[model samples]
Target: MTKDHYWPKALSKFWMDNEGKVCRLSSEGDLVRGAPAKFGVVGNHHYIDLEGPWSHSIESSFQAADDRISFVVDALNSLEAKPSNEEMAYMKRFKAGSFDSKSKNDFAESIASLIVRSPGFRHKLTLEQKAFRNEFLPDLPFRDSNDLKVLELRNIQIKYPEMIASLRASGKIIVMFSDSREFIFGEGFLQDIDGPNPLLPCKCFVPLTPGMAIAFVRPSGPYFSMPEVVTIQLTPNEVNLCNEITQIYSRRYIYFRSEQPVISKEFTDNVYYFLDYSKHPWMDGLLAAAVNFEDN
Candidate 1:
């Protein structure tokens, strides 16, 4: 069986430290550093059928999309707060032209790949499939296929192509940078802004590097007329919020480029407490109150 990387190495490589390895903080707060290849990998993660010959079609698509986006990300990595006129012009051109049609499709495919290629997503797929099978096909002969078969149903390239297409068709891509604060990435951090609905997120955020991140905002209501690609520097509080979101939504490990931990132990404790609190019905009222308090 082939080893597949759920997190594309190209993207993960951006988080490398001075020693050329990424720092990973586990949910339990154990910190470790390793090469990009050491994490986000699973054997036959894209494998669809045991009886069928192995194919690289899906992996190839991921590679193609990653290769294209790597250029954009690389440019973002080298970007400065006060860009030269040429650089600014290039960014403007990219906003006006590159983020349309085929390029936009590539961007969407890349984001969708990150979401659906994770172990968390696979597990979700497994549970949903198991539920459906139990409810409607309990007696079917193939209903008891191994977990591998069930999990592979999350191959986004095949099963959820429309998600990529949907991303391409709508939403503005915002590229945010921070000179004062660093950003952290989580294993399953492509989170829905409104809630847990992944298929149609009102907004979503992904931190590409310690200095940069991206968000896809559905263009409607208050967010109408948003540009196709927006590049802006984030406030320190906004940067913290991005890291907090990654921590809350992460399945297990959070990755960063920092040598020392960027997030505090107290913050982690609060995040765990919030996670527990979120399970109760009254958490909504609590959250509303917190938001109202913040507004005041």
Candidate 2:
């Protein structure tokens, strides 16, 4: 009976309005407001019916990660400025150094966990697994849905730690401060371009608050390489691009703190894709691969 928040409530609180509710633009093009605790949650989403009474431990771990990372987020949100790029580069290193290692690690793992445990990621995984089964193991007995759920949930638990380690080894953290409060994010914070694997994301972009975001940059990533830790300012165009990505990647709803006037029509125009699995944004690659396999 452990209700797990796929979108961690602690992080969602960042987008809350003065009324203590966040505005949610649903995939069906409906705008609604609700408390973070009620939204973005699923009953027993992370529960693994394992022995030793540790089925609820994953929720606890997520909560712990959220608690630790909230301080880092609050500190970032406090940075309200429009520094020039040169000044940003000069001051960013110092800003990055101010945070302790535990906070950074917790933030990293929290982002990874969110991606891994998301409903969108789970759907994509199911499609890929089904494709594998249909093509290679056609005669294999179909597994029970509950069994698969347990297996996936358990896999998330196992891979969570590994993902944190991978992020530490393969990527450097960067925080971006936005001059405009126009920034927004969704349940699917990281775009499809972020990575094919949730456990090993590359070039991930996560909006921490309307005024700030955090990213992980790989040495081989498209962006210019930087130090292990850095802070930077986002150009207005870059902020727009991030918001666009958020719109497409979000399967459930897009959360925002921007005023009602700023909730553009483009945000709700493509309502069909998210609600329909056949047209799911995350499935385009999988669909293309299936076509290639069939042709081959």
Candidate 3:
């Protein structure tokens, strides 16, 4: 008589028939005669070394394969929903009172397109300019430093008193650009005041690298009740300054508030002017003299 191999052909056929539906494989060797009463779990849990005829049984492997497929699908879906590192970085830059090159370019292009589309809008633009001058210009000191250089002129103007007052009240660090050169400096209040020396030492001047400029202004009172506006402007010269400054002061140490969204053209223009003057101190001095009418 031929010896019967322990292969379970009937169970293998049952698994192949119900491919999609859930099913369990029995640990018994066979059902026709020598099959055991209870089935055992397949794969690593049972430590059953499925081989040859038993390995080919579809019923023996379906459960494990299905579980693995489900896990892979869920993992892929999660990855799709998560934000990438680059996207996060861009969002951070927007929030931290800075504009990336692409954003700046897009903004400039949009403005240019608007101007081209409406030639007659020039009068309205002039009126808006005059209105801004009457309302907001008074608070700010007119650029008067002879050593400062005026790189580009925009129709916007800032109110100085409001800016300083807002800064002091908000308790945020105040960064100032010298009108005469591309040097940027910051100041912050001290935690403890001792009589006469209450105000802390002024922070070191950080040179505004050419082609880049940033200004952060908080208009609302403390508690961050109102959102701050961050303006960033860039030009060829400003870009150079940015490179030089970055080398001196690593970019990681630079911190500017990101909560405020920038709105006004005046703020953007001021940043441009600050960056220009910072690079050329001689031009700043000349600007001051010009304002005083000394050269004339």
Candidate 4:
């Protein structure tokens, strides 16, 4: 059989099997339930749920799977260049660490180091590692409210129900919120709402007053050295699109239509490409997706 024909089939089968198995492995924690040993007054009972632990385990599994997928993809793309002995050893270490059956922290530093050494995956992995570290060992010292900007909104109402409905129908809009910032949209927002809604399918718009928005800034600290602000902006169409894309693709790999430049030659050649590409496909995509906005 030809390489092209065989390879596609192989890839499809591999992806199918791995995706299912990974999903199942990640969900194993969820299958087990926890029951509390004590009961509460007024016919109320308390139980210590294992959901949190289960969720953590699932998240770890997903991260490991993602890392493995990236490595495989990179290897496939570089079929012409066989891996060196050292590289093969590193790959083995990575595979072992991914399923080490220990806490994510146990393998985080090593995996991060390995990922940084690749030119294709450094940026994405860096972002993922940062998020993981933040979740596990939040740099509380970096969380100062002084740098945050607070905004308020009032007298907000839904205006364009039709538009909202259309977006929801197309799996675009999840949830719409009116805030001090333009508006905010979150994934699966619409689906989570339980009630008889009167908003039109495509014409509904969530309205807001001046005090509805809030912007929080990440304070300067060792963990979060750079200052960043998160603004809640929601518009019917924008929310729909954002939610749709987020649902369809992992946030790390999704590219949005924004003013922010996806990539720059100076940024890519100097910083990004030199890092590991196996874990940072998004970075590669970013560089590839960049347009010469300067000309336009």
Which candidate has the highest TM-score of all?
Answer: 2
Q: What is the C-alpha lDDT of each candidate?
A: 0.59, 0.59, 0.24, 0.21
- Candidate 2 stretches with Cα past 4 Å from truth are 49-57, 78-98, 191-201, 220-226, 260-296
Per-residue accuracy of model 2 over 1-296 as CA lDDT, tens digit each: 77788777777787787888877777566888888667778888777665556544467766667776677687656543335353233333223323456766766677777777677667666666677778998998456776667666666666667666655553456566777546776665453323334344345567777778766644333332233455556667656666766675566577777443244444566431232322334223222221122100
Q: What TM-score would every model get versus the actual structure? A: 0.70, 0.73, 0.17, 0.16
Comparing candidate 1 with candidate 4, which one achieves the higher TM-score? 1
Best by lDDT: 2
Task: Arrange candidates by TM-score, descending.
Answer: 2, 1, 3, 4
Candidate 3 residue spans exceeding 4 A from truth: 1-85, 89-158, 171-208, 219-221, 224-296
What's the distance in Å from true for residue 198, model 3? 21
lDDT digits (tens) for residues 55-170 of candidate 4: 11111222342345333333322222122222232212111001212322222222222222222222333444456657986754223321110000000012122222222221
RMSD of 2: 9.1
Q: What is the C-alpha RMSD of each candidate to the true structure, in Å?
A: 8.1, 9.1, 33.1, 24.4
In angstroms, give how far residue 264 of model 4 lies from its true place.
30
Query: Tens digit of lDDT per residue, candidate 3, span 112-200?
Result: 22221121222333445556656887675335421011111121112112222222332122122222223221111011111112132
Enumerate clash totals for all models, in the order shown: 0, 0, 37, 46
Q: After superposition, how far is residue 14 of candidate 4 from its true place, in Å?
A: 36
